[model samples]
Target: MHNDTGELVAALDIGGTKIAGALVDGAGRLLARARRATPADGDAATVMGAVAEVLGELLADGRRPRVRAVGIGSAGPVNAAEGTVSPVNVPGWRGFPLVAEVGRLTAGLPVVLVGDGVAMTAAEHWQGAARGRANALCLVVSTGVGGGLVLSGRLHPGPTGNAGHIGHISVDLDGDLCPCGARGCVERIASGPNIARRALETGWRPGPDGDASAAAVAAAARAGDRAALASFARAAQALAAGIAATATLVEIEVAVIGGGVAGAGEVLFAPLRERLRDYATLSFASGVEVLPARLGSDAGLVGAAAAAADACGLWETAGPGGRRH
Candidate 1:
């Protein structure tokens, strides 16, 4: 970055469930972080306010470094050129001017926009599981299933910034309808909501105290719960099918999968591999390797910082030599 003292930046991961923010250095190190419930706030303005609040907190802490810009990894479908986002999961948000809002908070400091999945891939590729790999895919299987692609060692977010939507790929024509109104989508079969649907159909209670999250179901399966185990198996099958399709189409070398739903561990991965083997139609597709993501919560922060650093260009600050200052 800048010798031993790098420039600082604010980063945000705006997902359907929560909004996470962090102050990070040019080296992609998180200096401070905080999160708040996204659903508690209903509209786009409120959500932006929530992000502003976190950024405000980071700035209020005088001990932190000199922050420069703010970067956001928001849920898709976003217009990167215009800096607007309209995520399907968050209907309250419709073409919100992301850069403008964040810029106002940062005193016209640059703001960068990116898809959450794309940001995850950047984080993983830069510092976690996908590091050093040129062609790879990252899929997050949480409230929904989303994917990001890294091709030729660079992030490929596509024109409208909604590419690598692996979950929307249909595996069965007669499968359940998705929120997008499309039939037989992989997410309709394997995402958290669908997994819980599969469980409830088989008479599995999610418990009054706990939500029917993938984490809860995985814990139950590990404890020899039949319905929960079956739900995971079904989800794994869909996951493998989706993985095979992505591999065949993009020829990605490896796939990194994460999110709260992936906590099923081998309970989820083993069957996914086995199912993948069952579905592979050729040798090329069969070569794709699937693994778990290693960045955990930091993926979003690191990626958001990368987006900002990439945008600011002033992030690393050019040194006398060609190297980072």
Candidate 2:
């Protein structure tokens, strides 16, 4: 990492609900950061406009410094070879030429494309919860459920940059339908909106504020609300079964949970671990440790910057978009 010379890299985390930008150092430390709300309609042009606006504001700051590269992590079925992303929640960006477009915004600066879940894994491994760990899974449960893995110290983006997407892993062949047309995908069962939906179905309505988010569910659970607690328990079980399956196949050493749903803390994790223990078919998988993410909200931005810096040879350490090592 010494060769990085502490140059700033622009890191962008484009989620379904919001877009955030940061100037991060070679070490994945944010020098400056900004966030903008994404339009509920989620149009791709509008989303890109928001991204450009945030980047412009970042550049306009008097303290903005020379940039080395740009890194982006978005919801996706990314075409790694093309640096493209197709985030599911942002219906506007299917097959979107993300890397090319972002590169244009950056005036052709070198850019690295990554899935948002994978980006968080990169960030977590670079300097957050998964730091110093050789192999781990970083799962982000928010508007959607997503994940990326670091195995034996390498970032494994799979063939298409959507390697570690545990959300779409079907746990129940007859379970709920996923937007991806799959059955019982963990995302369908555990994501924030879905969790809130479950709470609503269970007769635990958050007031008419339409603020019935996963956080509200967690709050109610903490207050000993039976319906909220039961919903989270099911979500945890579904998520854990998926993680256990991944660990069984790939031998992940740890699973670091993050995002808004994970903010529920033990309400989400305790039962997840218990369920994994109950459902794991292999002995090695039973030992996989689950932990809270350490990076707070900046994991994506820092992870994106980390990926960019590493790809540009600013750092030698590989990030979370690849193998778990």
Best of the candidates, TM-score: 2
lDDT at position 97, candidate 1: 85
What digit string (tens of lDDT, one per residue) describes model 1 on residues 15-95?
878888888876667888888877634787787778778778877888344776777888877787888988777787888
Off by over 4 Å in 1: 1-5, 39-41, 60-68, 206-211, 311-325
Please report the candidate that would top lDDT against the real structure. Answer: 2
Worst 10 residues of 2 by lDDT: 316-325
274: Cα error in model 2, Å:
1.2
> What TM-score do all the candidates reach, one by one?
0.87, 0.89
For residues 1-325, what per-residue lDDT tens digits would candidate 2 score against the true structure? 3344557888888876788999887566677888898663767788788888888877677644478788888767778788777766777787878788878887888988888888899888888888877788999998888899888787776776778999999988899888889899999999998888998898997856757888999988989899999999989988988898899889998999998888898888888988888877577877788999989788888888877766677675564344322
Backbone clashes for every candidate come to: 2, 17
User: What is the Å distance of residue 134 in model 2 from its true position?
Assistant: 1.3
Cα lDDT for residue 264, candidate 1: 76
lDDT of 1: 0.79
